[model samples]
Target: MRIAIFTDTFLPQINGVARTIGRLADTLTRNNIPCVVITPETKFQGQRNYELLVSPGLSLPFYPECLLSIPNYTETFQKLNSFKPDLIHVATEFSMGICGLKYASTTGLPIVSSYHTNFPQYLSYYKVEIIAMLAWKYLRWFHNMCLKSYCPSKSTLKLLKQQGIKNLEIWGRGVDTELYNPAKFDFSFRKRFGQNKKLLLYVGRLAPEKDIDILMKSFQMLNKKHRNSHLVIVGDGPLRQKLEQSAPPNVTFTGYLHGDELSRAYASSDIFVFPSTTETYGNVVLEAMSSGLPVVAAFSGGVRENLVNRINGLACSPRNVMDMVTAMERLITDETLRKELSLQARDHAMTKSWDTIFNKLILSYQEIVCLHNKVTA
Candidate 1:
C-alpha cells in the first residue's frame, strides 16, 4: 500500500524524530511499499531513496534548527493527488502536519498521527509555562482528528489520554542492533577520549529541556571522588557555549558524531547517563544498551518504560542531582555490577529489532486503510 508521511522534521536534521522518520521511510522502501515524505526544505544536499516533497520554511524562533514550513496549498495538493497514497501519517503537529490532515480530510484518505515530543512540558524550561494550557488544547484538537494517535511508549499514551486526546495507541521505538553493537567498541576511541578513565556518555541535544545542568552537577560531584572517570558529551545545541565555559576539565564535548563514529562512542563508553525527563522515548538509551553500556537515567516519562532499576540499568529520581551522582558512583566503583548490567543491557537490546517494529506499524496502517475504505464504500 502507498503511504504519505507529513512531518516538519526530516533527515539531515540530527534529532530523534527526524532519524525515526528517515528509518521508517527506509524500511517501507526496502519492503517494496511505496511511500512519500513531505517536509520542510532544509540545507541538506544528499540523495534519498524515497520520494521527497519540500515546502518553503522559516527557522522557528524557539528552535532554530527546525523549520516552520509554509506550504502553498495548490502546489501541495497537486503533488499529493499525483502520489495517491492510501494512508496519510501526520508525524508532527505543525504546518506540514496540518497540510496532511487537510489533504486526508478532503480526499477521504485514512489518516493517523504520532505524538513524538512533549511540547507542553518543555514550556516550563523555556519559561513559557503560561502557554502550556493553550499548547495542550491545540495538541488535543490536532490528534483528535486522527483515526489513531500513536504514542512512543505506554507512559506517553497515558499522558495524551489525560490531555483529552482520543484513539491513543502505543507505537514503541526500536534500535538497529547491527549498527549499534558491543562489537563496535574501539579501544582507540576510549584511549583518545579518556585514556584509561571510565567514560560516562551523554548523547543528545545539549538543551535546557534535557536537564543538562543536573548532568553537569552530578558529573562534577562524581569526579571529585573518582578522578579516573570522564564525562563525554556528544551532540550540540544552544547551550553548548555556556556549558563549555562552565564545564570541568574532565568533561569533553564532541559536537556531534554520526554513523560508525557514533557507534564507537556508545560501544566504548562505560555508562550512559541521560538526565532528561522530557523524552517521549529515549532513542539514545536503547542505542547505549545495544552497545552494552549500562544506563543511568531519570525514572520518569518514556525513559522508565524500558529502564528497569537494577535490571539492565539503574534508574534514579528525576531532577535529583544527589541521586544521579550516587548512581554514577555506584557504576564507577562496582565493576562486577557494571559488567553484569552491561550483559543484561545487550541481551535486552537484541530483542528489539527495527524490522519487527516497522512490520507491525505497516500492518496497523493496512488495517486502518481497510477500515476506512469499508466505511466510505
Candidate 2:
C-alpha cells in the first residue's frame, strides 16, 4: 500500500524523529511500497529513495534546527491527489503535520500519528511553563482525530492516555546492530578524542530540554575523582556555544557525526551518559548499547523503558547531579561491572532489529487502510 508521511523534521536534521522517518522511508522502499515524504525545504541536500515534496518554511526561534513549514494548500492537494496514498502518517505536531491532517480530513483517508517529542515537558526547560496546559490541550485535540496515535514507549503511551488521547499504540524504535556493533571500535578514534583516557560519551542535541546542565555538572563531579576520564559531547544545538564556553577541561565537543563516524564514536567510548528526561525514546541510548557501551541515564520518561538498573545500564534520578556522578563513577571504577553491562547492552540491542520493527509498522498501516476502506464502502 502507498503511504504519505508528514513531518516537520527529516534527513540532514540529525534528530531522533528525522532519523526515524528516514529509516521508515528506506524500509518502505525496500518493501516495494510507494511512499511520499512531505517536509519543509532544508538547506542540506540528502539522498533518499522516495518522493520528497518540499514546502517553504522558516526556522523556529528557540529550536533553529527545525523548520516550521508553511505549505501551499493548492500545491499540497495536487501532489496528494496524484500520489493517492492509502495511509497518511503524521510524524510531528507542527505545521507539516497539520497539513497532513487537513488533507486526510478532506480526502477521507486513513490517518495515523506518532508522538515523538515531549513538547509540553520541554516548555518548562525554556521557562515557558505557562503555556503547558494549552499545549497539552492542543495535543489532545490533534491526536484524537487520528485512527491511532503511536507512542515510542509504554511511558509515553501512559502520558498521552492521561492527557485524554485515545487509540494509542506502542511503536518502539530499533537500532542497526551491524553498523553500531562493537566491531566498529577504533583505538585511533579513542586516542584522538579521549587522549588515552576512559571516554564518556553523550550523543544528542545540546539543548535546554536535554538537561545538558545536569550532564555538565555531573561530568565535572565525576572528573574531580577520576581525572583520567574524558567526556565527549556529540551533536550540536542553540546551546553549543554557551556549553563549550563553560565546559570543563578534557571535555570535547564533536559537533555532529553520522554514518560510520558516529558508530565509531559510540563503539570507541567506554560509557554512555545521558541526562535528558524529555526523550520519547532514547535512540542514542540504544545506539550506545548496540555499540557495547554501558549506559548511565536518567530514570524518567521513556528512558526507563530501556535502561534497567544494574543490568544493561544504570538509571539515575532525573536532574540530580550527585546521583548521575555516582553512577558514572561506578562504571568508571569497576571494569567488571562495565564489561558485564556492555555484553548485556549489546545482547539487548541485537534483539531489536530495524527490519522487524518497520515490518510490524507496515502491518499496522495495512490494517488501518483495510478498516477505513470497509467503513467507506
Candidate 3:
C-alpha cells in the first residue's frame, strides 16, 4: 500500500508524536509498504527507506522548538499526485496536515487521522481558554475529513466524541521491552548523581501543561523525610529556566537524552514520578514500566489504562499533591512492595507489542482504501 503522512513533527524531535511517526514509517518500510513523510525541516539525520519531504517553516512563538510549516500547495500537491498515495494520514492539525486534508478532500482520496494531544487542556494552561470553544469547533471540522479519527487513549476517544468529532477509534501506543529493560540499568551511571540516593525520574517536557510544578513541590515535600532521594528531570521546554529556579537542591535537570541513553536513564531510576495531568497518552509511563520501575502517575487519561494501583504501578488523584505524596511514600518505605510492582510493571509492559499495534493500523488503512475504491467505482 502507498501511504502519505503529513505532520508538523518528525524525528529527531523528542516528543512522542514525532517519535511515533518515525517508528510508523520505519515499520511500514520494513514490511514492504510504500510510505512518505511530509514534515517541517528539522536537524534530523537518519537512514530510512521511505521518502521525507520537508516544507518551509518558522518556529512557534510560545513553543520554541515547534515549527509551523508553509508548504507551496502547487508544488506539494503535484508531488503527492505523482506519488499517487493509496491513502493519506493527517497526524497533526497544523499547516502540513491541513494541506494533506485539502488534497485528499479535493481529489476524493481516503484520509485517516490520529488524535495524539489534548490541545484544549493545553489552552487552559496557557490561559487561552477564551478561544477554546473556537479551537474545538475548528478541530471537529478538520477531523471530519478523516475516514476514521484514531485516538491514542480511550479517555481521549470519549472526549473527542463528546466534542462532536465522529468516527473516533482507539489506537494505543506500545513500548519496546528489548530496549527499555531492567538489564540495561547501569549502576555506574546512577553513581554520578548520588550512589546511595533513590532516584526519582521524570522524563517529559517541562512546561505549564505538563504540571511540573506539582512534581517539584511534591518532591520537596518528600525530600524532608527521604533525604537520600533524588529528582532527575530529563527533558527540556520553555519553562526550563523557571523550573530550575523553583526546583529544590535534590533536583537535577538533564535537558534531553535519546536512544540508549534514554533507556539507561529509565532503567537506572528507582521510581518514575509523572505529575502531568494534561497528557492524552503518557508514552514515558509505558517506557518506565518496560524498564521495570514502579511508577507514580496521575490517575487520569491514558496512564490509567496501563497503571493499576499497587499492581503494575500506583496512581494518585490527578493534580492532588497530598495524594501523590501518600502514594509515593508507600513505594519508597516498603521495599518489598516496590520490587513486587517492578516485576508486575515489566510483565504488563511485555503485553504491549509495537508490531501488533502497527499491524492493526495497517489493517485500518487497508479498510479505508477498500471503502474508498468502492465509493469511487
Candidate 4:
C-alpha cells in the first residue's frame, strides 16, 4: 500500500517521532511498499527516497530544529491527491497532521494517527498550567478525527481512552540489537568521562517537560553521597543553558551522539537514570536496556511499562528527588543486583526487534484497509 506520513519532526533533528517515521519509511520501501514523507525543509537540503513537500514553518522557543508549519490545505491536498496513498499516517499532532486530517476527511480516505507526544502534561513544564484544560480539549478534537489512533504504550492508550479518545491501539517501538548491543561497551569512552567512576547516563531531549531540573538535582544529591560517580547527559534542547548552569561539576552534557558513538555512550555507562514522566514510550529506556545497562526511571507513564521495578530496572517516584537519589545509591552500592537487572533487561530487550514492530505496524495498516473496503463494498 502507498502510505504518506505527515509529521513536524524529521531528519537533521533527532527525536523518536523522526526516527520512527524514517525507519518505517525505510522498511516499507524495502518491502516494495511506496511511502512519502511530508515535512518542512531540513538543514540537509536534498530529497530522500520518498518525496519531501516543503512548507512554511519556523523554529519555536521550546523545540529549535522543529518547525511549526503553516496549515495550507490547498497545497497539501493538491500533493496528497497526486500521491494517491491507500492510507495517511499522521505521526504528530502539529500543523502537518491537522492538514492531513482535513484532506482525509474531504477525500474520505482512511487515516491512522500516532499519539506520540503528551502535550497536556507538557504544558506545565512551560509554565502554562492555566492552559492545560484548553490543551486537552484541542488534543481531543485533533485525535477524534482519525480513523484509528495508535499509542506506543498501553498506559498511554488507557490514558487517551480515559480522555474520550476513540479507537486507540498500542504500537510499541523496537531497538536495533546490532546497533545497541552489550558489546559496544568501551572502557576508553568511560575513561574520557571519568576513570574508575560509575557513569549515570540519560539520553533524550533535554527540555522542560523532560523534568531535567529535577534530574539534575537528583544527580547532585547522589554526587554528595558518592564522589566517585559521574553523570553523562546526552541530547540537547532549549533548556541546555539552565540545566548546565545548575548542574553539579560531576555532570557532563554531550550535545548529541548517533551511530557508534551513541552505542558506545550507552555501553560505557554503568546505570541509566531517567526522571521524565511526560514521555509516551521512553524510547531511550529500551535502548538502555538493550545496551545491558540497569535503569532507574520514574514510576509513571511508559517507564513503569519498560521497567519491572527491581526485576529489569529500578523505579522511583516521579519528580521526587529523594526517591530518585535513593534508587541511584541503591543500584550503585549493590553490584550483584545491578548485574542481575542488567542481564535480564538486555535479554528481555533483545527479544523485541525493529523487524517485529515493523511487521505489526504493517498488519495494522492492512487491517485498517480491509475494514474500510468492506464497509465501502
TM-score of each: 0.98, 0.98, 0.98, 0.95
Clashing residue pairs for model 2: none
lDDT of 4 by residue, 1-377 (tens): 88988988887678888888878888898888888888876664434567777787887677765678885678877887898988989888878888788778888889989988888887787888899888878888888988888999989998999988998988898899889988998999898877889889999898888988788888877887799898999999888888888887888999999889999999989999999999899989999999999999998897766788888898988899999999999999999999999999999798888898889889999999889888988
lDDT of every model, 2 decimals = 0.91, 0.92, 0.89, 0.86
Candidate 3: regions farther than 4 A off: none
- C-alpha lDDT (0 to 100) for residue 248 of candidate 4: 78
Off by over 4 Å in 1: 43-47
Query: Across residues 1-377, which tens digit of lDDT does each residue of candidate 2 receive?
Result: 99999999888888899889989998898899999999999654666679989998888888766789999989988988999999999999999999999999999899999999999998988899999999999999999999999999999999999999999999999999999999999889987855669899999998999999999998888777899999999999989999999988799999999999999999999999999999899999999999999999999998987898899999899999999999999998999999999999999999998888888899999999998899989
Candidate 2's error at 334, in angstroms? 0.7
**Which residue pairs does candidate 3 place in steric collision?**
none
Q: What is the lDDT for 307 in model 1? A: 95
- Evaluate residue 168 in candidate 4 and report its C-alpha lDDT on the 0 to 100 scale: 90
After superposing candidate 2 on the true structure, give the runs of residues whose Cα lies further than 4 Å from its correct spot.
Answer: 43-46
Q: Rank the candidates by lDDT, best first.
A: 2, 1, 3, 4
The positional error of residue 118 in candidate 3, measured at the CA in angstroms, is: 0.5
Task: Give model 1's TM-score versus the native structure.
Answer: 0.98
**How does candidate 3 fare on TM-score?**
0.98
